[model samples]
Target chain A: MAQRPTKETKQSSAREERPPVVREKAPALAPQRGRPTLILVGADKGGVGKTTIARVLLDYLAANNVLTRAFDTETPRGTLYRFHPDQTSVVDLTSTSDQMKIIDTLATAQVRVSVVDVRAGGLEPALQALQDTGFLDAVAEGEVGFILFHVLGSSIASLDEIAEVAPYVDDADYFLVKNHVNDTTFFEWDPVTHRKYFEKVETAGEITIPKLNELSYEQVEIAGAPFSTFVANRTAEGGPADHSFVLRGYVRTWQNRIADEFDRIRLLDRIAGREGA
Target chain B: MSRRTLVFVACSPHPRSGVSTTARLLTDFYLSRLADVEGFDTDPHAPRYHELFPDRTQVIDIAAIRGQISLFDRLLVDDGVPKIVDVWQRSYDRFFKTVKEIGFVEEAHLRGVEPIVLFHVDPSETALASAQSLSASWRDLPMVVVQNEGAAPLGAYAHETLGHYPSTRRFVIGPLDGAVAKTLEQPDVSLSRLLVAPPPEMSIVIRAALKAWIAPIFTQFHSFELRRRLEGAQFLK
Candidate 1:
């Protein structure tokens, strides 16, 4: 029989093999002089559940009594806007006027948090546009609070998107979200490769969205209501609806799991300015 | 005020723990009262409860979406009919998990229904731990610990441990002789029918034994009903 290396030994050996990376400190939760927080949710790949994450974030914020507004960059037919129509506006992020509608009114708007659901294949371009508009500069200068939830697909290519987004988020709260809503066997990246990419952004955190029952997810999609509303057995009009109790239960469980993950990361304390309180 | 609709969930994590027997007894207890009662047999493969009460019980597979909808959706309907579910060991975890996730207890209360768990006590340590876990998880929900001596007689240690759980009440099913137990196992056996009108073919000695076994259990159930109604009245006052 052979003796297995202890966790400490393995960690020390790995540290000796790899270079020590410079880690960034956490940002002040209460933004510089109460600047509103902006969260950009995006993935280079399509069908990675960007809107779903945005919707869950909106729900979490709403449950915590944080006033939030969302912008769906999918243009004329935004999926996020359909589910959260009251506070979401469908816009083309490529257009300057819509960008102004989101960025220019950040401090003036009644909403304390702004969530932007960037379209597929739009992450790099979105970051570039933000850099061109000097929003990244403002974040770097501590003039505003920024959080980028880089939703990742289960592909090596998705890891490549992290490096591209890292330089822009040096001062932002970057999170790599592994969404398992559609597929359970996700993120088959080699540990070394995964660590190498993660090391690109030292302040980056990982959040997992657990798999939800397909039927329940589809039912919520068909109902066109928020997750909380579906769990409450209410229709889009706020009246009692006849949704299946089993499906509603599954959704409620899934939402609670996501909420737990958010709470674990101190998401409300991080972005809602709750730390000061 | 009218009596609140009741939903009795007979459950155990291990097979041969007298879960089905408890469910059967509850179903018959309601039937003896002439109240409208429905039973859900979660074991679609071996639906003994449904077979016994085919007209009143529905066979449901709790693992499947369609079956879950059929069971839970129907349970939410407040038409004043009581429901009893025989949670097969294979479906027990899913059944309780779904109930907690859906917030069924609270919603059932709001709809004028009370959900009570009839946790059958087996001699196994697993059974004792599971009952304690359930009691801790749903502290507000009413639970009744059922000690079925004929199925799985509890040892002193197991008995003492289960006694500590915060159960609303304890119902003990006394052991029956082998002949009577075998006779009750028949698919067509109806306790209510036996108490109301014993068949002529049944031996007088066997009839006497069956009556002695069932009458006290029914009396306990009746007393529980009276106590519940009294509590409701006091709440109103």
Candidate 2:
């Protein structure tokens, strides 16, 4: 410039030249309808019974007559899909197209509640993806509801995962789950350390899944049916099943106990968009 | 019309509180009528009820899950066969807890099975309290208090105390002559067998006394069954 530009002018020009932080736009709002809820169930470690928690959530939602659809992000084959094939789809949460399939249809889907079962060691990435996709923005703006069930294993490292996932869930309903379906003992953690990690997310709550009888659990797995279906003594095809009444009784008792835990947490109220209502 | 199956649960929390005696009476009563009946003896250590009716009864350890399935699942079959269970003193708490948890009573009703808890009332305050507690908690279940005068007789005060229970139904068993009571306790002596075919060595006097002692009790059972059938008919109507 013929007249040497002032420092303030140069700074202003540089600021104006910076590119904008681009974000995918939130999906269009449904016409004057109830806000859709998305529940993400995941764990940092494998074999932590996170999938079992997802299955129980589906059963619980169905029991409460909540119209719910589920996405199992376990690649091409999802365990939740096997039990509840009618209402579930297998998807890859990392893929942009798959994420669109879930996010874009939120307002248009007939079912208002969606459960996403994140694969093991995928919670951080999944949460990061939600942050990047403007889905979390939709949650912040009250256009959608978000819930995170951070299923924890019995180890100190599980606590670390909680801190990592805590940032993305500040505006969401967060729960830490201790699943004892397969394991018997909950490893003792130093109270101070435990409190430190737990307090990282002040609003997070704890849920315990009681241990079910081994034989009963095995029978349910073998039947390849939902817990409620097995308890009803029905096959995967909705036909009469010759399941052992003992195993069915055990499953019913276990399922009822899990339902009690859900009730204690007011899960129905939270998921139905009726909290404090 | 199909008859509703009856499952009589003879239970007492105290040992020697006439639980086995009540179960035996019910089993013998059904057997004498030629009704299809099954008995479950929940006494893991001493299965006296099973021993008394080996062909018709099975011993089950109700503390275990498998035993619970065997007892409760079979009871729910509703095959029109009357069922009797002699719940041992040690297994009493576990038994009722499981029943409540499984909602066995309501399911039994839906399946055309009526479970009647024949609670043995002794002279002890513990017995009275247990009965009162059960009456308060299990209002849906039909409970009958059985007072066996031979084993655990209640004095006037104890009887008056038991009268305060919410249960309106009460059954009295025996204040039998010493000899009749002793003879009935013999392991080989089955009341149903005695009624059907008395042993040759048994004297006519004792047999007649036994018949006199059992006639009114059997009549009581018959009346109860008639009333239940009428109730079922009314329900269907």
Candidate 3:
């Protein structure tokens, strides 16, 4: 268990530096307090509304009177920055490294609400490193981690993938986030078909996240910088005009439905312990 | 001798790029404060979100991830050193059950040396801890405790359980960015190595407004069955 001589040898030779390892939890503001709330927005495929959903949740927490922050494992182009400025968010231009630092910062302080957006395939590796580092155990000991999966029409294929990765999510509070609903017929999988798809994941011993829908053109534009700036404005352009017709008229209705359910999952209530709503 | 490879783990919906989006962000954030940080996106090969960002980050694609361990092993062997990794977890518990307890153990055995495990506490420990508690199987893994405040006891417990491992470490940060960090007087181990950095300036209001306006889009996709699907993600069909 002594420090390896090889590491010393390598350092001695080139003076090259490895990224500093973050094994212990970061220091906190104070000690005798509660842990922060950590929420993860994930989906196997791109365009499944992972970033969008995470943004909405963070916005809700901020608007609804909570100290909230957003983390994007995906870099430079943080979804929050598409709309808000740097001061408005801990938007890391570097993505994963920034995310780890922010998490370390938050874990040290134990911020109340922290929303995370994972890029399509990065979840496994990032989680692997965190586990190796032991921050996962630290976070587990302090906060509640919610896994949010955005599904549209319950693509059976996507669900099958979700099942394979389900074991990785075994310990967290899982929520299926149905996103970008252009129509509302409420999905119903044929029991037989559903069961068969699940078998694939089980047999493979891994989650096979089903395919998902990406945001529409209007959504993309809305999530883009120029338009996001308009939305971020304070006056007419900032107020309502900033948002696109699609986002204002349709997107809100769609996103609210899921948000309401989260409100219902009563995670906050559970955190507060029945004393508050 | 082969140095253990570095592996990053987390929940589903991984970014397409190879390097971690979160790790890239933190590195940029810190490096940016001092100087420019180059980023590269290697999705097709690494396929992780962090890899997809700017060219400043050296994004590894799927191909890179496929051989990430061996690659690191070779690099470390050539360097004559044990592999050092900066692991990032979006949440605590998810990490505890998977990487720290399971993967780390394996990596240690494979590399013939202790693999460095770094945990990022992104503003919450309750949910993370709850998840670990639910998974209870990895109760005995060495973990470096992270918290805002009053999280020392929890950290101490974890430390006592796994602190015996030579690879274990701990730290705390806050009281500046509207955060709190607490511990019982002094940790059982020497608190000399704790890494406390200045809190990043992040706003809650802007984030909230963003969510409210965007909620409908995400909310519209929910339903009783969808909830069931989410809960039963383990048994998806």
Candidate 4:
């Protein structure tokens, strides 16, 4: 399906009046020519900011002009859908019809990216479902761009879940995110313990989501807007906002840092393949 | 809706340029007017301002994430509470680097909180060069060259170098009496408080000397803050 950009009752945007948004990426970058890409953002444990990371990835891809669609596996009334309702569909990942809906559309959809906000405790089952469906095999043949964002908490089990999930993403882009956006600690694992499991994921490059100011993060949650829109001091519909300048500053800084991690990992190239980037 | 909240990052790239002393003075300046002020002493090794005003000040380590959140988060609040962060020469680059990278000045401006970098000028070539580098990087933000006359005579920094700043406002923090300076170095000493209730043991002569020493510097700072007020602030006053 050709997904149109969300056109909520548009208002005069603060971004339109201000100078152009600063681009740290290649300023004149073109759309990716890569194969249809599927990015799974998931964690075995809950509250690791997996969905939060997924939202940031979608925002980053949107900023780069990637035609991106999303599947919120939160079943009904997905939080992802709440923030990005127009581009997202809440689907049960285990259902056959839903699996086909996500997998079959990869090649046919106008969008280049398919981001799945895999629900809490649904990562392994989702991966196994894909494996059983022979989707990873197709991914290996270069028919699609497959990437896994394994958002890990600061627990040993979170690290152990890495080994369990590594087998499924062997042919895909694997990333272990040490999310500390709201957490006080990112990794409770000692250096040796971290390195042991870190060595297991063959192509995994570490991506860190830095801590955001508690107030700014909460404001975004309250506004129900994407981080980019929040930084622009606008609602999701692009209307001007009454957000505190200081809080917006904090969010802008936090957003740039998350983007920096994506840049460091060359996430665009990985999702688009070398030629597409 | 702001009352012109200002966050002054009083610092020097090189040590021994009397940054801590001046930062303490700004804190005292605000405190003297009974204005709400918080002092952040960034030198983890030794926090002089934190020692002097334990209740009003906090010691911060910008290297840690929590420290950054606590310091920067509070710095932006426009409660008519002026904030002063004293940069250790060691944490100087990291502190300002984070500020610039995070667009702290731009964000602060939007919230009606102006960030002023008070670069302490000394009688060294490094001080002059540091001033030049900062003037270039912080051109959009207001900056002031603070000449510590007690450390060295004024005009050590080249006049041409100083002229390059977009809004260069120089202030002197010295010509203070040597004896009074030694007394103010006490951990419990606060010049603002000293002007208030005179200590029982202190003679009237000594109190008068203290007032005389700080009068000119305080007046200079008062005008400096007055200049930074937004339009209509003067009319309201």
CA shift of B223, model 4, Å:
9.5
Candidate 2 clashing pairs? none
A73-105 per-residue lDDT for model 1 (tens digits): 998899999999999999888889988898778
Question: Per-residue CA lDDT of candidate 3, range B1-237, in tens?
Answer: 223222222221111111142333233333433433332233334334333233333433223222232223232232223222222222223333333322334434444433323332332344344434433544433333332222122344644533332233333322222221112121221111112232234234533333342233223212321443464465545
Native contacts recovered by candidate 2, as a share? Answer: 0.33
Candidate 3 lDDT tens digits, A75-161:
656655554443235444234566556555654554556666676665555454445545455545544343434342356545644
* Model 1 clashing residue pairs (backbone): none
What are the per-residue Cα lDDT tens digits for candidate 4 across A54-119?
A: 899888988989879999999877999888888999999989999989987777778878999999
Cα deviation at B71, candidate 1, in Å, is 2.1
Docking class of 4: acceptable
Docking class of 3: incorrect
DockQ values of all predictions: 0.54, 0.32, 0.01, 0.24
**DockQ score for candidate 1:** 0.54
Model 2: number of backbone collisions: 0
Compared to the true structure, candidate 1 yields what TM-score? 0.87
Q: What is candidate 4's TM-score against the reference? A: 0.65
Q: Rate the local accuracy (lDDT) of all candidates.
A: 0.82, 0.84, 0.40, 0.78
lDDT of 4 by residue, B71-163 (tens): 887887777678899998988888877787567776687777877888887656777777778778867777888877776554645466556
When only the first chain is scored, the TM-scores of the models are 0.84, 0.88, 0.63, 0.84
> Cα lDDT for residue A79, model 2?
95
Residue-wise C-alpha lDDT for candidate 2, range A1-277, written one tens digit per residue: 1122343443354334634435466665566368898999998889899889999999999999998999999989999999999999999998999999998888789899999999998998898788778888788787888999988887778877876666567678888898887773445446676666665455547888998867778889999999999989999999999887767877888889989988988888887678572
Put the candidates in DockQ order, highest first: 1, 2, 4, 3
